[model samples]
Target: MLDLARIIADELAVKPTQVENALTLFAEGATIPFVARYRKERTGSLDETQLRHISERYDYLTELEDRKKVILETIAQAGKLTEELQAKIEACQQKNELEDLYLPYKPKRRTRATIARERGLEPLADWIKQLNLSKASAALTPEAARYLDPEKGVETVEDALKGAADILAEEIAERTESRAYLRDYFLKQGVFASRIKDDYPEGTTKYEMYRQFSVPVREIAPHNLLALFRGEKEGIINLTLDFDETEVLNYLESREIRTKVPEIRNFYRELIQDGFKRLMQNSLTSEVRSLKKEWADIESIETFEANLRELLLSAPAGMKPTLAIDPGFRTGCKVSVLDETGQFLEYQTIFPHTGDRQKVEAAKTISRLIAQYKIESIAIGNGTAGRETDRFIGDVLKTCDNPPIKVMVNESGASIYSASEVARDEFPDLDLTVRGAISIGRRLQDPLAELVKIDPKSIGVGQYQHDVDQKLLKKKLDDTVESCVNYVGVDLNTASKELLGFVSGLTPTIAKNIIAYRNENGAFKRRKQLLKVAKLGPKTFEQAAGFLRIRGGDNPLDNTAVHPESYAVVEAIAGDLGIPLTEIAKAGDRLKSVQLQKYTSDRVGLPTLRDILKELEKPGRDPRAEFKYATFKEGINEISDLRPGMELEGIVTNVTNFGAFVDIGVHQDGLVHISQLADRFVNDPKEIVKVGQVVKVRVLDVNEQLKRIGLSMRSRDRA
Candidate 1:
């Protein structure tokens, strides 16, 4: 634990004490949102982002320790455990390092070297190892012939010698220290070079990215390296680790040959070169390159996860009747209405095909919904018939004598949601088209809530999402969903089973049971009521209850992040003073009088107690609403209407390692490249902006032919 704290402190460049304090809060089951918002003084003002980073690193180190235990046990069982080995294993910081130490003991298939050892050539191989053979023929003899059987493929002294060398090579490859040293040396010194395959046809542009590409191991771009390795693996190209052979031989000779007996030195030199070239070189090169690619993938995924969390937490329209149009042509346009709280109200079919009376009826229906239910916004699906529908809605609004209703394009994954089993259960009576409309309407009201029903990939947020590793993409996207769900507290009473399923530590089965319990019993009146739900055990409750908000519950703390188990502590605090637990909500000054130490326990430590006191101050407060809102030009609807230097409001649709894409009143989002993220240099796109964040950006360049808009957040010019 101390070592873990030290590593985190060193990596984050903070004091061990600071890490210890932060970990204490995290261990006590405090949410990152709570710690960053309320316990600022304890964490040295490390924001939620920093706290989350520390928490993740902490979990990784714990995993490393568990792996170390398994490796140590495996080595012990193999009878190879020594005090030195045990100490090294205990101190190991990474999984790769521990696995490297355990490589020799790891079980493997029988190879050529194992077969040679099984034959009576073991003694002969030992004799060869001791021989100081400057000349190869001096050590060669017919007496070494008894073990040299042509039936087993060893026909002569040369064949036996070659077999002995193969044994030596395998032994060298298995040596933990030798492999480690060689891997590091090569990674630091090796240069990666690739050439187009000879049979790829002359002047092929398929691998133009790697044809002339050469970079030092340290300086190579991860994406480029991954692409090249992928090409090579697919037999589309040939790649090599280029290095001067003489220099490599000299380095190995210096390490292996202490005395310069000419014959012995020559033999060792040839042996080292042969062993490296035949066995270690290519294997180690590929391993190191794989490690580099994995590291890059992790970093990219982490960046993506952070951006996705922010985007999912972006503010929703919050319980307003909204008209969602899934724009289309031959299929006609699908329209649906969501009630004040985003529940599906009604849906209808409308066609605006070039010219149709249905278009006018659609306009009248929208206006009626706006008048009847006070619909604040129209969420048009940013898809096929989007532009034409936008024009239709604009024409309708221009002739209206009512409150100006804002029309916004919705990124509709509604069709996917409607087809899902969850949607089927939610709306069994409705058709797929009606469900899609409801999905679009509800998405505008609360994107996070509606989008959680569909798979994130189907939402179309990334570049080359389908091409990447599916398991990796799903894990990353799931992590993003978990982080987002926890970041924005879930409404215990109103949240759908899909939304609740995304909450940290809660699964779909558990979420459904919770909703079932709610439906059977009533709305969850307190966080403790979750215990009554089937399959929702204590551990699941501990992880999820803090992020669930129960409004108008028996205790005000239930409506906030305050855990149910801490109710006694709050009661005790209230008892210490002349007040009731209910009055503690209004007695902010008196609540602060209670010392956290007085209420400390194994589970409810100072960290947890301190958080409980803060929640008492402001119950049911939303952490996200403090952020700014998105506002675009009233009349600007089409991409062609966008001119260079026009300042307009936009919602960040997706954020990548490269940049954040903003949907500025167009079906296609403009790239606010990492360089244009801010006036200053930005290392990560999430640092300056995030997915779903509303930011004012200026049009820097517009390429109509390419259907691309280059935007910048730096300028303020309105053309």
Candidate 2:
């Protein structure tokens, strides 16, 4: 096998030393976020993306190497392996190529060729290879007549020749080079077309748009390819591929049939064409589809990951005593009150949307809660009865002594979390809807901390998320959550087990143990106290400590990203400045003025020193952007209220490859297509918007019957 690390380095445009160093750290169990943030010097300052690519590619190569060993061992034990065969297998770079090379020797059930050999036709097949009736031959039949064995089921010379043809066809199908050529040709030239199955009704499904679709394999978009495969799987459509069979037959003949004898050459030519149609076509076509699906899955998973990352890193509404409402029409609204730290204080019921009398009582109840708890903000779920409830609350605050900031929270995954095992454990006795309201409130308090409790898939920010490979989707989403959580360091004293589990090197078990310890022994005073938690050893602490912040701890550096090992360098810097460590916060200018070279040692470099100085300037600062929210236009409560050329303010609910879906005060989301995303040309929707962005758009068209709203940001920006 080639040097896998060196090859990955070339592919990613990084140095070999960087790959080697990163591999060493990965072997030592370093997390991607930790290595990207702290080990910049060792990795040549590679970012999180480069590090993740290295990790994923390295995994692929290692698995490939292991597979090669197994293949070699299996072939050798079968006594079919030769020195040249082993070299060829070892040099194969792609998994598909390796599988193709091994197909001829792979174990199999009884096949036609194998059965023909059993009928004592092997000798006759060898003779056919040498018998080129090119110059002169009495007749091919005369040679074939000698091999007829009636007792062995070969009744005549014709039957014997038929067995020889089957053997030749099998040989042509198994040639590795031919298989590769056909697979490549199918990818480049094949045309995929799907039509409504004859038995199904014409307008029975959402796949009607794809009923007459036809596109070349190479030109199909990733989303369209996935949709076509899904449509075929559901039996709504019959899918077929069109290709030039004559051209394929010609190529196979030129490569396999060299004999000029009109008689023998014609015999081989028939078998060659039969082999392509009967054996090679279907097999290679399936392979090409699988390869395309795998590529499409990768692209879709990446889009999902990018969207989830943006949603998770969205700005928070910060800490405030808040009142949250999960609105409903018939069931009335479920109200939950949260204290400043987001602990559920109380829950109640309100019938704001029921009638005039009920609305009056709802307003009085809301006013009392605001006055009693000193609530600073109100979060209303963006669901049924949401607009009506917001209007009700706005009217009530008009008479109140102090009003709170009202926000319409995207409640996509709140119900999923409320019904989850985590939610049940957090609020065992509360009603499900009440728990959902509490989640909405906490989502406003801190998005990263609260959203971590729910599965990223349930958040509903991805495009074709369910259609992609589940294992890849889960892994990428998990990595995204971890990156976001670590980017905004977790508060050691207040973080839940869900938030702690995503910390670098901290397992779910360790997170539970920390929470248990804190519940029993009180809040952690310093970073060193983590040693008291069960199963948290030196290595775990080393990787996780920098990301865990202990606010108001005894040692001030415990709250910053400075690892425990680098405390000595910090103390030395404080000592040279003639100040106590606590007063180091007042000497930011002096810390910057210090000669960084003088502080470097064998174990510490400029990278480490620079990070330390930067931390000293602002310790434990949140990396998320300041909070902001979109305000929906008043009186636009439903799809019927929208009109062309009406300007509206909306929040982006989901970003996809072709467009961004925005919530413009109607339950139905409006689409801002890529062409209308900006005044200028827009190649990527993500470049102009994200999952939780607040964007202004103009209504282009609204179909009330279809409940579809087409929006345009280009015209709005110019206006």
Q: Output the number of the lDDT-best candidate.
A: 2
lDDT of 1 by residue, 1-719 (tens): 23888889898888888788899987786656556644556777776567877988898889988888788888889898999888888888877777878877777788767777765566776666656432343434554665778777778877776666667657666667767877787678778888887677756646776876688787675556667767887788788777666776676666655544565556566777887787778777878877777766666566556655665776676667677788778888877877777777767777776466767777787677667766677777767767677778777777767654554545646678889998889989988877887787776677788888888777766544543566787877886786677766899888998899887668889998988999999887878888889998887787787789987788777777776666777788888887877777898787777877877776566766776777788876666654344555656767788899888888887777778889877667899988888877888677887676788888999898769999988745322
- Please give the distance, in angstroms, between residue 717's alpha carbon in candidate 1 and its true position after superposition: 12
The CA-based lDDT of model 2 is what?
0.89
- Would you list the C-alpha lDDT of every candidate in the order shown? 0.74, 0.89
lDDT of 2 by residue, 419-477 (tens): 99999999999889999999999988888898999999899888778888899889989
Candidate 2 positional error at 334, Å: 1.5
Q: What value does the lDDT take at residue 246 in candidate 2? A: 85
TM-score of each: 0.81, 0.96
Model 2: residues >4 Å from true position, as ranges? Answer: 130-139, 400-402, 716-719
- The 10-residue segment of model 2 with minimum total lDDT is 130-139
The per-residue C-alpha lDDT of model 2 at residue 235 equals: 87
